[model samples]
Target: MSRSPEFVVKSPAMDIVIHSLSDVGPDQRRRLCEGARGIFWDTAEVKDFSSETEREGFIYKYFSYYMEREPELFFCAFSDHQVFGYICGVADTRQHQELYRCADHIPLFDDLYGEYPAHLHINLAAESRGKGLGGRLIEALEGALRTTGEAWGLHLVTSEGARNAGFYRKNGFTHEVCRGILPEEPRMLFMGKKL
Candidate 1:
């Protein structure tokens, strides 16, 4: 990968380590993914999340399913032995069916912005927001994806009015498409950036 194996970032609170998901044990991996759910998949989105067990399962399925399946393409932000955020990516949108069969259900950009051969999903804990760490996470992911010779760029889908479009644009990603696939879910905006 074009990115370093690991890097230390000094924030006002602590020094955070950004590294591959494989660097941590199973327990920590689960912890990190679960910890970021509040920041990304808020409890308000899950109508039936009345208990911890119910909420955990919904979050895991919606957010960390790919993360649990693909460790190599995932990166974690760790500080003081806690996960502050993470970015999970796939090098090829077409091959998602190979890793997880439900790719058919996901919104497709392959027909439009097909040149961007990679995609990413990012989430950061509340305290970690606006610290410039989110941009760093995107750089780490872009660098890692670039190492794969086949990847020309990356794309990601974010919900409309979540106020995250600017973050992607700030990192050089361009919004290419916006659509709603399911009646219950918010419209999605697909953004892409060339390597």
Candidate 2:
């Protein structure tokens, strides 16, 4: 593949750089992974984890697959060399399902996998929100996924009434393709956008 696009986003207050996991140094990758975990916990809609360990493990389970196997799909936004936001996804949902054996986890995901073969998770630090970093990260991931030509579109699952729901809708994920509630949580929304 050709070089990934440069994703340096600048604002009057600070300069933010977005990079796929594949492009960062080992140290930065490690920082990004840890930062991502922190951001996930802080922004997660589900807060039923029994302990911090379980919470961290949950983050690992969802993230390690893409970080290790599809680094290019994992994009991290950094400000002053610290990770503040990120967007990560699998290019093909089948690969993620096969690895996690979660075909039945999200309702209609299996049925809709052919058209929306990719899925993503995005999070931003509290201070980073409202500054357009999330949209930039989403665009970066979409560009990378489109270049691969392996997915027809990308999808994401967020809790219904999620604060980020409006953000996703604004970023072009308008289709409320599916909905289901995970155990102990409110309804979840499966939103998608065609590439």
Q: In model 2, where do residues sit more than 4 Å from their true spots? A: 1-3, 46-48, 51-53, 98-104, 181-185
C-alpha RMSD values across all candidates: 3.6, 2.6
Among all windows of 10 consecutive residues in model 2, the one with the lowest summed lDDT is 99-108
Regions more than 4 Å wrong, model 1: 1-4, 25-44, 47-61, 98-105, 182-186
lDDT of 1 by residue, 1-195 (tens): 224367677977689988766666777767765565545564235466679987666655445665676677788788755778878777787776643344432544557447776888887887788988999888887767766565887888777776889988888987467777777877778888888
How many angstroms is residue 152 displaced in model 1 relative to the true structure, after the best TM-score fit?
Answer: 1.2
lDDT of each: 0.71, 0.79
- Across residues 1-195, which tens digit of lDDT does each residue of candidate 2 receive? 432786999989888999888887788888888887778778765679899887666666566666877888889898766788988888887766554553334444567777888889888899899998989999999888777777888888876887778999999998785456456656667888999
